[model samples]
Target: MLFRQVTHDDLGCASYLVGDDAAGIAAVIDPRFEIDVYLDLARYMGVRIEHILETHNHADHVSGHGRLALATGATIHVHRLAAPEYEHEPFDDGWELALGEVVVRALHTPGHRPEHTAFALVDRARGEQPWAVLSGDSLFVGDIARPDLAVDRVEGARGIFRSLHEQLLTLPDSCEVWPGHLGGSMCGGPGMDMKVSSTIGYERAHNPLLREPDVERFVARSLATLGPQPPNFEAIVSLNRGPLLATGVEATPLTPRQVELKKGEGALVVDVRTDQQFDEAHVPGAVCITSLSAGFGSRLAWIADREGEILLVGRDDDDALNAAKLATAVGIRRMAGFLHGGMTSWREEGRPVATIERLAIGDLPARAAAGELQIVDVRERREWDEGHIPGSVHTPYHDIDAIPAGIDPELPIAVLCASGQRAAVGASLLARHGAKHVLHVVGGGVGTWERAGLPIER
Candidate 1:
């Protein structure tokens, strides 16, 4: 038996390659948009990828099953409830697929989505009993999947209750549980553990949601704990369900003049440089979403309109290519290519550049006291509720598409988050939304202020 888990930290998504070495056959579960990883893994393992198993039609990121199938001539398997347009073997409750001594049995766990399934793995060579379960979005390490993305919140929560109690819980306490997502994924609540894997016994004994015996109470609690849905979530789901979309091999390299024209024609110029590099200089009106951050793909998706074409400005060809691939992972595929030679080429051609003002947390107090800056707290609601600068306006970073009311474009606006990474994102969004005199509050955030003995309002 052989198994390997490929995780995309940016999206908190995991895909698995499970196979039988003797049979030289393997199956991939919940693949990401990039199929090369699986291809490389299969080649290295000396195995042929014969099956592509989708736990469900994903709503957060596009699946690579189509591309994997095209590359390997593999059979794609998905739950019938997905009604996917791509050719697939529609699987349901109790369906099983075998690879030599390794048997994968599907447990129809409909909770995160109506079509959600958990695959229990059995090594017949060792024993008939299953050893592990790939609880795709049906369960996380410490938290269960959020019951709101696919169906009505109430109905989905009810499904979650049943799926947890009747299906997953039925597994032996010793069975290893590998979830589809980890911490930082929007699919679950704040309690998702960063640890990669957990056993059924640990979760059953320690998970807060599992303690609720009453279905109504469980539904109410689940709905109450829901976080903001992933940006363009519905569109992502549609893309997954519709005809299979192929990943692009390369992005066209554009001259500075061509990039300008694309921008004029409604293309978004996304600068993927570091925050310091972007703050120093960038294309005028470009949005800064530094590829340095782990959540680069997600942040880009959050700010970019699904219909708009993205024009990437990277540090170099390699940087630009990586940025484009990350963008594709989140289903933002309408790329207009990248600026050749990056910002350096633009500067050589005497193209215009812009810079954002940097503000330190220590200086923030004086600015607020003098009414010289309007501090826009771009952290989450919970973060803001815990404590915030007295005069700061609570506006979550992802929701910074428009300049909220009472925000004066004339005044210098400082965008802030828990860390400067999100602050840079918010600052860029503010600039794109036509806010003049935007400031990227770097160095630190509200926590910095609090730690320095500055006053805050709860």
Candidate 2:
């Protein structure tokens, strides 16, 4: 049996490919919208993809079922209760999928979604015991699924509670459980423990959701605490209903000359790069928003207008594709296009640029000596207590939201974080909150400074 788990860090989704190499057939489960990865893997493994399966109508990230089936000539299988408005094969609960010696059986595990199902892989000859169960959204590794979903909203929580008791808790204790999501995804509740997958025995013993008997509390809390809506959800899922686009956005690439034209027109240019690279040099009016290449599309959707025609600047081919995906994801119908040759070509073509001031670890000593170094660490509380630069003020990034009333917003503040990501987010907040002087440390270089024997306000 050949099994591989593909995890996307940005969205925290876990997709699986289970195949029998000897049988020359395979099944892909819970894929993303990008179809190429699975195609390449199947080709490299010298096997044909025979089926595509989805555990539920996912809410966190877009699933790549349509494109996979279109490209691989594979059949899509879902639970009979789903009644998906697309072409698919409905498998009733207990239906079996056979691939040579490998067998996959579906268990109707409704709750997270009314039609949810978990697939259990069986090897009867190897033993009557099962090998692994793709728990889908029903059970997360360290967290049982939150009952809330989009359609039915709170009532769905009640459904999920019933599903857990009826379908999952009865599984063999030794069943190796593989869930569809991990930590950091909105689909699973925040109460989720920090792991991607765990055995039934481990979760049954440790997961608090399993401790509930009446199921009423489980339904109520899960309903009350659904995570932030998944970014670009409706549009992404809707994309599947149309003709499949090979690349997500399919926007035309623009030359440096073209990007310059957009900037001149006052378009908000975004250079999705690391802070160090962005600090080194950038197009004059661009901002860096760090996210996975493909997932960046959703982030872009948040900042840009629904029909905004904007310029995208990125480091490479994947970056450009991701930028386009962002445009498409957020329903931004118009993309003037991406910077054609990227920043390098822009500089080569004599396009003017700007540089963000970067501060080094050693610079802190000089600032401290001069008596105007007001450090504002924009990390979470857990991070703040972990150890921060001495004499620094703490303002967790997300919480930097509210401009604390009566506090001097005009004070010279240099936002610092573990790295540039949170720092950038903090700096942007300060800038928006009417702070006249806001700068962020290029990297959280305090640790380096301490390692070099610099004085810290212990």
Candidate 3:
């Protein structure tokens, strides 16, 4: 038996490849929209991919099941409740698939989504007892899946409670628990762990949610602290359920002249460079989404207009292409292309540019104290609750489409997050939304403000 876990760092999604190398057969679970990784792995292992299995219809990112099936003539497997429109063999609880000595048993764990399922892997060569379970969105290393994506919050919470107690926790303590998502994913709550895998015993003993014995309290607590849903979640879910989407997006290289025409035609330009580089100079009205972190896909999805086409501007061909791929994975399909020579070429051609002015945290405190600046804390609610500047208003970065109430457009508005990355995004959003005086706070945020003996409003 052979096993490999493939993780998409940006989305914090995990897919699995389980196979019987001796039998020359393999199966992929929860594949993303890129199929090359799985195909390459299959080739190296000298096994033919014969099956594609999905624990549930994903709501966060597009699945590459269709493309993988088309490429390998593999059979797609999903739960009957999922009711996927694509060609698939629908199975219910206790459904099992055998590949030589490897057996996968489906546990109907409907919690995160109404049709969610978890797969338990049993290597018969070793023993009849199961060794690992792909918990899907049902369980995580430190947190459990958020229940409100596909159904009502309370109802979904109730379902998750039962699913955890009746199905997942029933597994042996020795069983390895591999979840569908990690820390950066919106699928789980804030307490989600970055570790990819954990033993069932560890989670059972240490996970906070798992320790709650009461069902009603579990339901209430589960629904108490969910973050905002993923951007375009409904559309992403619909696309994942409606049909099989193919991969292979070739971003055409657009000349500076072509880029200008597209921009005039209402294409949104996304600059995927470092915040420092983007703050230096960029195309006018372009939104900067630095692709250096795992939040790149979600950040782009949050900022870009889904209905409009997007033109990517990056440091080079590879950077632009990477941005395009991440965009596609999140269902942002209306890609125009990428700039051929990047921003340098645009500057050489004397194209107009825009630069966001950066302000250091050291100066922010004094201006904020003097009531001369409207500091916007664009971090999350939890972060805000822990610490924030005295007069700053809290508006999460994702929700910065308009000026917050009581904020004056004429006054200098400084945007700051944990670091300056999100502040760059927030500042640009404010600028595009017609905030006259926006400043991107660099150096640090509330933490730095507090460390420097600056006053903070708890």
Candidate 3, residues 1-458, lDDT tens digits: the string is: 98999999999999999989999999999998898999999999999999999999898899999899999999999999999898899999999999989999999999899889999999999999889999999999899999888898888888998999999999999999999999889999988999999999999999999999999999878777788888988899898898788766678899999999999999988899898888899998788898877889998888778898999999887899999999999989998999987889899999888888889988887777777788899998978988888768899988887888878888889999987889999998887777888889999888988888877788
- The best-first sequence of candidates by lDDT reads 3, 1, 2
Candidate 2 minimal-lDDT segment of 10 residues: 237-246
TM-score of 1: 0.96
User: Of the pair 1 and 2, which is ahead by TM-score?
Assistant: 1
**What TM-score against the true fold does each predicted structure earn?**
0.96, 0.76, 0.97
lDDT of 3 at 61: 94
How many clashes show up in model 3?
1
Output the lDDT of residue 225, model 1.
67
lDDT of each: 0.89, 0.71, 0.90
lDDT of 2 by residue, 10-45 (tens): 666789988888888999998877667788889998
lDDT of 1 by residue, 1-458 (tens): 98899999988998999999899999999989888899999999999999999998888898888788889999999999999998889988999999999999999999889999999999999998889999999889988898888888899999999999999999999999999999988889989988999999999999989888999999988887687788788888888888877655468999999999999999989999999999999998888998877788888888888788999999987789899999988888888999999899999998789889988877878888887888899888878888999878988888876897789877789888877889998898888788889999888899999998998899
Best by TM-score: 3
Off by over 4 Å in 3: none
Pick the winner on lDDT between candidates 2 and 3. 3
What's the lDDT of the predicted structure labeled candidate 3? 0.90
